[model samples]
Target: MNQTQQMNNDAVVEVLNASGASDIVLVCEHASAFIPTALNDLGLSAEARHSHAAWDPGAKAVACEMARQLDAPLVASKVSRLVYDCNRPPDAPSAMPERSEVFDIPGNKKLTRNDRETRVARYYTPFHDRLKQVLSTKPDPVVVTIHSFTPIYQGIQREVEVGILYDQDTRLADAMLEVETGTFVTRRNDPYGPADGVTHTLKEHALPQGRRNVMIEIRNDLIETADAQTSLAIQMSRWVADAVTQSKDISCRV
Candidate 1:
């Protein structure tokens, strides 16, 4: 709970290493599976509440490790995506989805406009505002959002180990892709892409600012263990650092 700040009564966002010197800013939009006590776990079973539909498993651990290794500030959401997806725009249906994969969200099924707006005002705005505040402090900040994908989605198994995703700007993604990852299978937007509304965070925060950014998706199984998260973080830290250096060089010439 260290470095945790109560952005609202629900404590929607938590920041780590806020004064870190790295130009990179780490974000975990799906960092937690906490549905406010009042939401009643979004009417989901305990199993469903802890499932991938609620949050990106192991993503926060990876992001935290990366922040430590990179000396970068990490801003992460403290509420479940099922309550309100921090990565999505307030207008997007998926922002407050009634269903995720095969699981229907009872609490969200019949939401009125007021219900939706309340969630947005209470959860979404504060999370993004904190993220913005962190990024604003760094000159030419590079945004790196960490996420984890289910190995089997809708019963289909995915083979890609890691995904380097970008919207309009690919400077960081491209450079990271060039870094050899040894056995890890990395691609540019494999499990999800812009079509899946996975890049909303990048579009909203980094694109408008013209900051170098990349959304990284790792298979949840890859980081299922704490040791694995740390190992991956160490490797990713090197790759991201190298990529950031290359991106800055490219920006200087532009």
Candidate 2:
């Protein structure tokens, strides 16, 4: 365990239902908006800390509910994405982004190489390592990363409610999209695609190992309330269960 002490104190990665039996493994990379007290909120305004740039609101709730519903394990990052985006590789510029959307992060502006590396070690590495460890417990696990997208980005309004994203492997994503849900509009990749470099976690964890995977993004407004979050989680849990069963059936035949 190369876990950094500072990040450990913050509980960088939290695993729920570690011994769960379901083939699905849930991951929430932006589960929280907590920045270390020592960092001074990463030099952002109070409003920015709770914004989409810092964390995916309602994502952790959905992931937790789905995990319970499906009897699956969940691995989530506790620190804010602004401190260190767990989804991104250490080398990516946005891994410790100085600017996110329209907000400038003053703390990240003049970072030294060591500063960046320290963040990676303190936050990113432990989160991913814990996720990997959880996945290693199950054979042929389906990786489903839960995320929330702002309805409007940079003044552009996104109409799609659910975005099921995948890179080269689309087994789980294709299955998910095939599930019938008349309530919300589901698309392959609408607001943020693989071209947007949002598939880092799936690519790093699922792609190389040839595991089934999908990155699900829901509009933040759709799940702004607790009732709405639970409703969406119930709907998503059924879809995920169906997708996992279908994918496994296909794999067995091949």
Backbone clash total for model 1 is 0
Summed backbone clashes in each candidate are 0, 0
Candidate 1 overall lDDT versus native: 0.89
Quote model 1's TM-score.
0.95
TM-score on alpha carbons, each prediction: 0.95, 0.95
Q: Which ten residues in a row have the lowest lDDT in candidate 1?
A: 1-10
**Cα lDDT tens digits for candidate 1, 97-177:** 999977899999989999999988889988888888888898889999999999999889999999999888888988898
Judged by whole-model lDDT over C-alpha atoms, candidate 2 comes out at: 0.89
lDDT of 2 by residue, 43-117 (tens): 999889989999999999999999999999999998999999998999998899999988999988989989988
lDDT for residue 151 in candidate 2, whole number 0-100: 95
lDDT of 2 at 6: 45
What residue runs in model 2 are displaced by over 4 Å at the alpha carbon? 1-10, 251-254
